[model samples]
Target chain A: MPEQPVPRTGASGVIHDLGYRPYDGPRNGSGTIASALFLSGFRNAFGLGRSGKSKVLPFLLLALNLLPAVIIVGAMTLFNANELPLGYARYASATQILVSIFVAAQAPVLFSRDLRHGSIALYLARPLSSAAYAVARWAALLAATLVFLLVPIVALYVGAVLAELDFSEQTEEAAKAALLAVLLALMLTGISGLIASVSVRRGFAVVATIAVLLLGNGVVTAVQGISDEQGELRVGEVAGLFSPYSLYRGGTSALTDELFLTPPTGAVMTAAYFAVMVLVGIAGLAGIVLRYRRIAGR
Target chain B: MEQVIRTRGLTKDYGSVLALDDLSLDIGPGITGLVGANGAGKSTLIKVLLGLVPPSSGEATVLGLDVIRDAAAIRARVGYLPEHDCLPPDVSASDFVVHLGMMSGLPRVAARERAAEVLRHVGLAEERYRPMGGYSTGMKQRAKLAQALAHDPRLVLLDEPTNGLDPAARDDMLGLVQRVGQDFGFSVLVTSHLLGELERVSDNVVILDSGRLLRASQTRDFLDATGTLLVEVIGADAQTRMGHALAAAGVPVQARGGLLALDPAPELGLDVHDLIRDTAFDLGVGLVRIQADHRRIEDVFADA
Candidate 1:
């Protein structure tokens, strides 16, 4: 950074006045403010504008998340496989833990730090309203999470096309996976963001988010696995509704031709899964807005 | 002058506790000081002005805009430095201020330029690129002030700008605040529990006590000469000798904190200044100083 001109000092060693230039430029409204906040929050999720230590965790997780896709692509190219080995939608399911960890680790960075450090007051004291602040942050996290979910899928899609696979089929599958990723990103951002906002403590927020995303998914997966063994498909399908990852899986199974251990069967079950998942996501975002409103009011 | 802030019967009641009680006041431009002890509703009043907290039974207008109806407009034109810590630890002060400047609706280039200017004004030019997590309390406070000023609002409300600072740093912060209001052409409403600090920079002073307005007047009024002279003599038992001599000489002199205090009475037909000088000379003591004692903001609370 270039050095700013130091205030001149006089004979008595007193600092002279460096004129404070008033801003006579055009100022944008709240919409611009909210978009600026959204962009900043998006950068914060991956530690782009933060300290060196903060960058380590998010990038490490991103690298870990992308590793499997790279290995699968290499294997496909080396073997000259006629079919794409990994399903685009199934890739997220296979790497669900990485996604869960990323969301759990990063949600607090976006949602909790401001509240925890009392910096939310600075933001609220601006032209932006508390609800707008919350929504902007939520949208930023949604965008970042979408990036995380889409990168591997895009990598795989590129690999499939490069390896002489059917372009249209690959495009159709990637588009479907992208749609499911949006839905999944919406729900994940909401759940983790809400938990981080309410909990305040970063560690507790991370643990709670992981519990809601990973542990809940694990239990549901176990129940689904057991029900599959018992030929009780309905029990497994209903249990899948309890976790975001399971909801994503049910979404993937319903929207795409991907096979699942216990997929929600029929049009009604699939529609119900989609509705509940979207509702939960909306509710979480609402909770975050309400939480910030309360803080701003205080 | 038009009122920068006008509050009419402004009351903020938190169940079982009243933060502000039927307060009515009009504050014009220049640096006005809000004085109150802890829990004296100083913070509450700022919050209400900023529209972060709503008044329960009254109304307020900041910059002639209704606090409720035009809160967004008020916020756009008014800056606020919250009493609490508000800087993010991880981000550099430059980045944080620019981001907040944008959040205040400044364009990107304007935000960046304004952030740098304000940071420099607050004496954080070199350290602006450093993460605030490593900053000293004074540096953090400066950074906070920088962000508040980044958008060049017409008015800035600073809550206890000198809080948690050593005497030197506190003086620097107060100096910065004074320049912000006077040289920079921004109206300021700064709050402090330390009455003396505000008296130096504030054009007007508003004192609050137990959720009620204790006093609101020009800083000069709170600091008006109380018609008493403080006498300080440099000698052995100077205060005792002066007290006895003044009392014997028909002057009602009282010793207070190593100084003799006396009120001049016309009826006595004695030149008080000459008497003090003569007494000190006769006693072989050096007259260190003699000056009028002024009433401080603390005296307002005492009088109340």
Candidate 2:
């Protein structure tokens, strides 16, 4: 016996006959982990890796500044000396310069891509909030920068210990160096992430980030130079509070004279400067996140 | 069934240009085709419903959640496939979908499982692990569809799902969309400028013209059968002579190509089929076909 032919219906008729069902299930922790992993994979797919082209220039800039530190470490070990080599202060300055460049270049692209490509809609569609998204991207930036900074620091630390130097002071110095690296990474990452979130265009974001980081200190320095003939220690400390670069200089100067510009008069002043700079960075980042949420909510 | 979307005077402006002008609409469950040409406010409506853009005026709710006040709540249960190609090209379809599922508050294992299930449903099982950059256009669309489904939302807003696809691919995408609404039981608000295409898959269609609501009705109402007949006959001059004979037999006729179009009035005691058959028999012409001409939505606006 032959099978019966199916009856024909209008286009809408076939859809009605299908009897499709909606999906209903529990959303739990497993979902969040999967989503973060997916976002990470997506970022990596777009050539956002540590060694990708987007990061090559910044990495090279960092490597150039760290080269002198590498040589100074070798020289100190060869001479069996406790002090850093000549011009090590300038090398530290170079490290700060490289960090500024890195932050300026990366912040805009990280924040603007979603807005430019219309992927922000897809992102907001998920259970994620703008604050969470901002935090995740900032964390990624900080982690990447830490790898760049820590690799050279670790090489120098191990080289110093292997030289059979005074064991007691060496451990303390190493811990200081690690703490300094964390402070620098956090300062740069937070500032850049905040500025990047201010706009949807990469070029504008980079310009704004750079202007804030570089020009902000210049304005403070000029104000101090004209107002105080005595190079007051308090003014320098106050300036450091306004800028991450200044704060980093003040912090590192306490550990090594190569940080240039004399250290703060007291530990309290240094701590206050560090606290204020970090707070400012956080506030800037928070403002950007709020603005992004407003624009994206549309 | 509950209404999936409801909007009142929803408006949006881009600088001075009003993208969505005082639009109000209600869309129920199942497939609704939001039909409009490019720049005709279709995308604006979808964006407003998804809570991605703030409306300049008015209010809206999706799944009974206020679009502005409950944006996060609305987003939690709504899925969206944007019109543009925004997928990260370097990521595999499975990984991307899984990540999105997790971001939507799913557990890791469950997100992975749901990702696989959605990819398979969209016919991307074999290539699910390959980078989306290497996938074909059809595959990319499927990957986008998979991500939207991975979270198991109550409704999915698909903007121009068939935008760049060829006829065969368009048909395939349309089929998947219909199945998504049917098999998954998710309400679908899909958009397109092609009236004929959506007529095939949409249960209801809302037409927008120049940022204004033109019409909204069930698909059948827009595609109602007109009381007119299209009669075709064989042999040379068949339409010309048939037109005269239909007139002599007191039947309204107009010659259109090889067919004589007749306006059938029920009270006139006119049997359109018999009039054509008997007229053809008398004229010694072979009757080829007789069919009713259904008026399409496009025809309703042709004069305008």
Candidate 3:
């Protein structure tokens, strides 16, 4: 190695005065800002723009969610089955934990990171108001979570169609699956977005999301087991409303009572369940927006 | 000159602690230096002007927008560089600045273009692609300044841009700030606790003491020469000999603060300066620099 000259510790540096010009060009409004934030948030949810380590959990959970559908579709083709035993909605319910894990891992990437790093200040100080910023983030998380939860269901439908199954039944089930997927997205985004916004640490937000979705379901199930049915409403069905993921699954199962082993929750009871779930989800979502509004632009 | 900022009875409090107290003042358009010790309402004033914090009582306006009723509008036109470390560690500077630019209502293409221009203006160049976590304090400050300019704001509030920088880096940052306000034509409100750091860069100075306004005026006003003259003679014993002769001449002279002072009274004669010059020559001492010795800007805070 060549020896370097001893450098002066303190010396003056010259910088040319290449001043900046003011921007007089056309500028977009809050809608465009929100859209930009949405796109950025969506990419962040999947760790697309982040380091390799950040992508690990999101991709791993996504692959895990799809692997079961691939196996089921392959088995159906191999066995010359005319109908799928696992319906699309039931398939999502059966693998609800993977979808929940995806939400847990990715929601923090969208919500907790900016809050933790204090970059929310930069966001709020722009044309984007706190409410708009919150909505954009929620939309991104919702869209990403929906894609994660519904892609396998789509794959299931496509596989069944390619395998020469009953096309009419498959199409009907696909529509039902799409509706359920949207509901599941709403529930996950509302709850996970709330958790991530409040818990600024990514690890803590992820753990909180998982605990709320999974452990909360377990607690509700235990409660239902202890409580004897009071009337026509089943204890298990009523208890599922208390947890978001179970609520989605239970609602889907009730809607497709003929296709599954679980007894149908009456139409009225199911509507009430949905009403309660939406209110709860909306409350948590409102909390996320309020959390940002309180500190937004500060 | 247009008034860039105005505050009337702007009081802010946090429970029992008062951050700003009845701070009524108007700042004209130029580079205004905000000086105060820590906890002296410097940051609070900036926050109030930016509409980030609501005043407990009072009215304020920035760029013709009310601080309360038009906070969103005020924020739209105002750029703020917070005092604390607010950069995210994961993202590169280019990505971060572009994201902020888009937030400021610039389209994606325009944000990208403006981000590049401002980053170059701040001297970041190719280093803009590097993650901000690895940047030095000076580099990080420049990155912050670049984002502030990303939206082409009418005015910028920079809270201690020279904080935690070395001497050379501080000078560079100060020079950049001066040129930005002067050449770039952006009204600037820069804050520092160091008394005279903004002397060369700022056109106006506003000093705050313990949550109250101490002084606010043109920088040169506080530093203007007092009518008295300071005469410095060359030699080891020059000051002493000059002092004695001037005292004998009854010119009301004394060695005050290392300079021989002469009262510039009219009755002394029109050529009192010439008399002093003659006295220095007769005493066989060379007269060096004879000039007005003005009171330093720090003198105002010395009492406070």
Off by over 4 Å in 1: A1-18, B237-243, B281-284
Residue-wise C-alpha lDDT for candidate 3, range B1-304, written one tens digit per residue: 6789988888998778899999988998889999999999998888778777788898999998898888878887888887887789888899999988878888888889989998988889888998899999999999999998898999999999999999999999999899789888989999999978888899999999878989999999888887788888776588898988987876877677767888776776657788888898899888887888786789887755
Best by TM-score: 1
Estimate how well candidate 1 is docked, as a DockQ score: 0.76
CAPRI class assigned to model 1: medium
RMSD per prediction, one decimal? Answer: 5.0, 6.5, 7.3
Instruction: Report the C-alpha lDDT of model 1 over A129-228, residue by residue, as the tens digit.
Output: 9999999999999999999999999999999999989999999999999999998998999999999999878999999999888889889999999999
TM-scores, all candidates, are: 0.94, 0.79, 0.88
Which lDDT values do the candidates have, in the order given? 0.91, 0.74, 0.83
Candidate 1 backbone collisions, by pair: none
Model 1 scores a TM of 0.94
Give the clash count for each candidate.
0, 21, 0
Task: Give stretches of model 3 more than 4 Å off.
Answer: A1-18, A224-233, A258-264, B13-15, B227-291
Candidate 2 vs candidate 3, lDDT winner: 3
Order of the predicted models by lDDT, top scorer first: 1, 3, 2
TM-score-based ranking, best first?
Answer: 1, 3, 2
